[model samples]
Target: MTKRRGERPPVPEALPAPVVDAHTHLDACGARTPEQVREVVDRAVEAGVDRVITVADDLDAARWAAEAATWDDRVFAAVALHPTRTSTFGEVEQAELARLAGQPRVVAIGETGLDYYWDYAPRSAQHEAFRWHIDLAKRVGKPLMIHDRDAHDDILAVLDAEGAPDTVVFHCFSGDLPFARACVERGFVLSFAGTTTFRNARALREAARWVPEDHVLVETDAPFLTPHPYRGRPNEPYCANYTLRDMATLRETDLGELATKITRNAERVFGLRDAAKS
Candidate 1:
């Protein structure tokens, strides 16, 4: 098959309760300007995805994320040099990220961790950057949102070695049951993206089911990982409903109840209690 392609999927029905996109890339999703960001967020709100944590993958993205958070009360930010871009990490980038980390709306230091899947950056450079981001998260007293791809073992090793922040989230959690258990034991939150809805992602579904309600979160990882039935389509924050609904089905929980629970989890992890209330 040539495979289907098109614009972002249509927004699903509003969730029974509001939830958060724990990790996403607004800039990459083409929401670069304030108006564009609001347009996207407005649609997300219509789908009951009331808030989001827009994450950065590089220095420029870090800047954009920080500013984007300020663009809307519903949007917060996570700043970091992604694993693939860690090769360019240096004093200048470090200082900028540090500055952005302290911004009022920047809630976490991340989308950072090991990614052995893409060899864009050497393992050594990724390791160094990951450790630095871990420390940065600690210094800022914010959660660390990790992006662990095919480097689960090393990601865990680094977290152990550097000691983790009080709050850590494995964004787009791709781990199987064992790894999920390990993360749960360590009290690290696992944010599931649309991939969990894939029919072939049986292990991921099992892991999601095994996760304690308190440790589970839902995200779209927007502009990527659109949920099943729309797997090849472009993703957006509004599509978070699809993933969360699928998650509810997989976990055998009430959709509204699960939405409320994940919303609480995101609030706790991102320190968004005030935002959640508003």
Candidate 2:
């Protein structure tokens, strides 16, 4: 419909700009609608975070993640059925997930892996689904975004058996020093999230130190795990600063240097440079 002559023209608001949000869940975090995503992205860009990789754990959420990338220049996506959703995977599901993998905005193949802590699904199912995702990642030539929760040993075993991708990342890394050392030695990227900012998360701090500079990345995992100073509140990409600052302190480096290194690491692991222009 054409606008009426007497109607005021729409005024364009300046973009807040963007930074690199390694991982998040815009759809699950109440950024369900495009407008909500736009508002959050605006705040994030204003805070110097331009791009965010929105991840999803199920088919519906996966579609939303992909749609989010379509809605804004600041958003990208990762699709997979999380470990807890192992029961949801089936022949049809795998076919659909593979179809989503072909989407241009879908950059990685995960948030998938083992999680013994919750055990929402059987161990065998989780293991099988994990292998499926790894195979899909390899077939699609995309990086694997892993989620290991109290199941690091099993996760590593399977990844090794399945021949993990050349570009693999352990998102929201909360492992002990030994695990961190092993991951770094294997050339796997470890992404530090808001959990890294907790004062009492000493183990994570130690693990942060163990991750090599080039193998380290940062994320918000927003609407959850809000970092310190904003703890007990909702998380957002804008709050990534707290975790980044904590990481800088952990590595005894300047914040800018840490950010630059993490950004580079994200690009290398996720093949962000190969994505279509936002």
Candidate 3:
């Protein structure tokens, strides 16, 4: 694991057009209070990442995420008990998540797919929690944000079995081209993270290149997958510009054009109305 060491990468030049850090963790990024949230967001805005969706990984995070969304118009929220944290899942947890998922600014039910890598929670518990989140997304009329790690097959199987929500976003998409194709065929959206910019992530880069514009989005997944050249350093929403630039180069498209498409896609999927301007 890359320990948090060294300085964070300097903010890259602002995007030609604004984009959203489709997935991030404001709490992990040290933005708990309203003022802290605003500071983080202002940095992102300067880098042309105008909005962010701060995703929750547990009950406390879910509450903070919901409250954080209320602090700034550009900040949104996705509430769910992360799959690894589902070992104690129960009725009270379900009711609270259901309630948080309904908040107007809580736009998705997510960061809640399967993770075979950590095996932190029993597979059964993860599966059960994933299914519940899927159902919650459907009920709330919001998108489902997934965190798939070495469980692509099982993730697909569960989504298939449960009947996925109308809108689904694979946050920090880690699959290869074939998996990307499958997800695209299912009308699911892939939110690429800084991982795509790594030198060893050739397959991920290929998937990024092949995925259709409308079926893709960008994120920082900050405080974790900081873009290449800055790997192992703390990340913030502003770092999304680095990932966007990397994707644009690989896709052979203009940065602004890709930014526009991704911005539009985030707005459309999140049901935002001029979010950057609002």
Candidate 4:
């Protein structure tokens, strides 16, 4: 099918088994209103993506993500200020995030690590904000979602200094095998995005191929990283199946089995089923 309006790529075919998009941005995917969010999630469901965890990148997004999760049973939320937006992290922002993080629908405290790629926030501010988020995650007993961009060493260092959370997920994991091994050894989950499908992301592919089933999860990180063949196009939760297929091929495993394992990993890390029961 041709690209949709806004150059959105067509949703990929459904996987054999249901899968969860462990990370994505419903707001960035052009789904803000409750109806829009539900529409977007429904599209993903049609593609066999059973659930999605919409991630927040700032204070406003944190609020939106929290409420958006309540909009649909299939939608969950992760709240945190993006490292690039840490320049303004203060008492007010922290308080709001803490409140939002406590929401029943909020599953993780994340997308909060360091991002050396963007000079938007100074290193000092990023470090301070990152530490605060780490502490919050620890207190809340939720997984810490990291957004490591060209700051792998520092990211790991900060997590160590702050005492890493019980469940730490490297969102859009942009690390090589060595770093991946280090995270795995520490019992951190690596959530792969569309980048794993990029032909040039051999190092990332290696990490994805080798990460044990129990420690792995999949995400879209969309309306960005649209996966191979659709790279540069707008992305949404539905596109996760494409990345799953690629990873299955890369790992030389059955597509359905890999899908099941990844979904289960997501469930365990985010306590999805438990949250629903409560």
Clashing pairs in 3: none
What TM-score does model 3 achieve against the real structure? 0.96
| RMSD each, Å | 1.7, 8.0, 1.9, 1.7
TM-score for each candidate, following the candidate numbering? 0.97, 0.91, 0.96, 0.97
Expressed as tens digits, the lDDT of each residue in 1-278 for candidate 4 is 12443587777778899999999999988899989998999999989998999999988889889988888899999999999998888899999999998987899998898989989999999999999999999888999999999999999998888899899999999999999999999999999999999999889899999999999999999898888878887899999999999999999999999999888898899999977764
Worst 10 residues of 3 by lDDT: 269-278
Candidate 2, after superposition: displacement of residue 267 in Å?
Answer: 1.9
Q: Write one digit per residue (lDDT tens) for candidate 3, span 1-278.
A: 34556677788789999999999999999988899999999999999999999999999999999989888998999999998998999999999999988888888898899988896899999999999999999988999999999999999999999999999999999999999999999999999999999989999999999999999899999888999878889999999999999999999999999999998999999987733343
Query: Between candidates 2 and 3, which one is better according to TM-score?
Result: 3
lDDT of 2 by residue, 1-278 (tens): 12342331221232232237788988766788889999888777666676789998888888778877888866889999999989767998899899998888899998999989896899899999999999999999998999999988888889889998888889999898999988877778888898888878899888987777888888888777877655666677766766777777778987776776677777777767777553
Candidate 4 RMSD to the real structure: 1.7
Per-residue lDDT of 176 in model 4? 96
Whichever of 1 and 3 has more lDDT, that candidate is 3
The worst-scoring run of ten residues by lDDT in candidate 4 lies at 1-10
Better of 2 and 4 by lDDT: 4
> For residues 29-124, what per-residue lDDT tens digits would candidate 1 score against the true structure?
999999999999999999999999999998999998988887788899999999999887899999999999988789899889999888999999
Q: For candidate 4, report its TM-score.
A: 0.97
lDDT of 4 at 107: 91
Which segments of candidate 1 are over 4 A away from where they belong? 1-4, 274-278
**Which of the two candidates, 1 or 2, achieves a greater TM-score against the reference?**
1
Most lDDT-accurate candidate = 3
